[model samples]
Target: MVREILRVTNISCGCNKVMVTVEDGSNFIADAVIITMPLGILKANFIEFEPKLLDRKVTAISDLGVGNENKIALRFNNVSYPCLYGSRAFVYDLEKLSDEFAANFVML
Candidate 1:
């Protein structure tokens, strides 16, 4: 059961169980755990992991560059496609259409 939203300070993936510690000195243990924290938090080392992430995983996370992204949810009362708002980016490219577009766009 999820309690209040508290600041997570540590995560330990042990052989028996996974432990998640919050700033309020509370620990949550479970048989399995899934963390969905942002890349910034992982890159900043905000929360300490007990054993440590693998070297390749650490390198991959460190290599990931974080950029500014703005998200806005719009509500259109009269629109037929209620949630079909187009998300656009002002990308300047020499080619009209290029495979580079695929590389730049990521769902998450």
Candidate 2:
């Protein structure tokens, strides 16, 4: 049976069984486990494993750089534009801005 896991901080697996430790220091066992987290979080090494990730995987994780992009959409009730059907949207490349401008801008 699969139990609802919450805030798992560590995972240990053997040939047949999987073990997980929650934030409250509670341990549980399972047949299989799936971890869902961002690449940055996985690279942070906050979660401990019985045996660490493979060396190539660790290197690949470390080699990745973080990047962010914004997407915008516009809607109209009755108005129609010239390129509405063909080219409906335009992508504003924020990467074109200076590093200083990007650093100062806030998403929210």
Candidate 3:
């Protein structure tokens, strides 16, 4: 059996209702809806809703930081450093590396 799927886009909200624009430029209305967009997009103020969110909720949202960091893997066919010196090595002030490199290395 085949199922029908509806794609709603361009959502706007007011105090008590939400308006959505569909692919065909048709409009839809709803009483309440849950938006599960990325926190980053929410933080960027890409969408707006009326009857503004509660003060505490707004504060929480503002305080939340989106992890914009990235990771890159540099795989090697063979180990460049000898293992005979022990398993651990020391590096000072590692934060000097680029943000992406620092985030990736911290995971190791």
TM-score of each: 0.59, 0.56, 0.41
Error in Å for residue 54 of model 1: 1.2
The sequence of per-residue lDDT tens digits that candidate 2 reaches over residues 1-108 is 555647778999897998999889988888888778777777898788887778998899899987897899967786432232223232244445566655554232
For candidate 3, give the lDDT of residue 86.
Answer: 30
Worst 10 residues of 1 by lDDT: 81-90
lDDT of each: 0.75, 0.72, 0.63
Best by TM-score: 1
Residue-by-residue lDDT tens digits, candidate 3, 9-83: 467777688776655777767886655777876777665545466789888998998776789889989764323
Q: Where does candidate 1 stray beyond 4 Å?
A: 70-108
RMSD of 1: 9.3
Kindly indicate the candidate among 1 and 2 with the higher lDDT: 1
Candidate with more favorable, higher TM-score: 1 or 3: 1
Best of the two (1, 3) by lDDT = 1
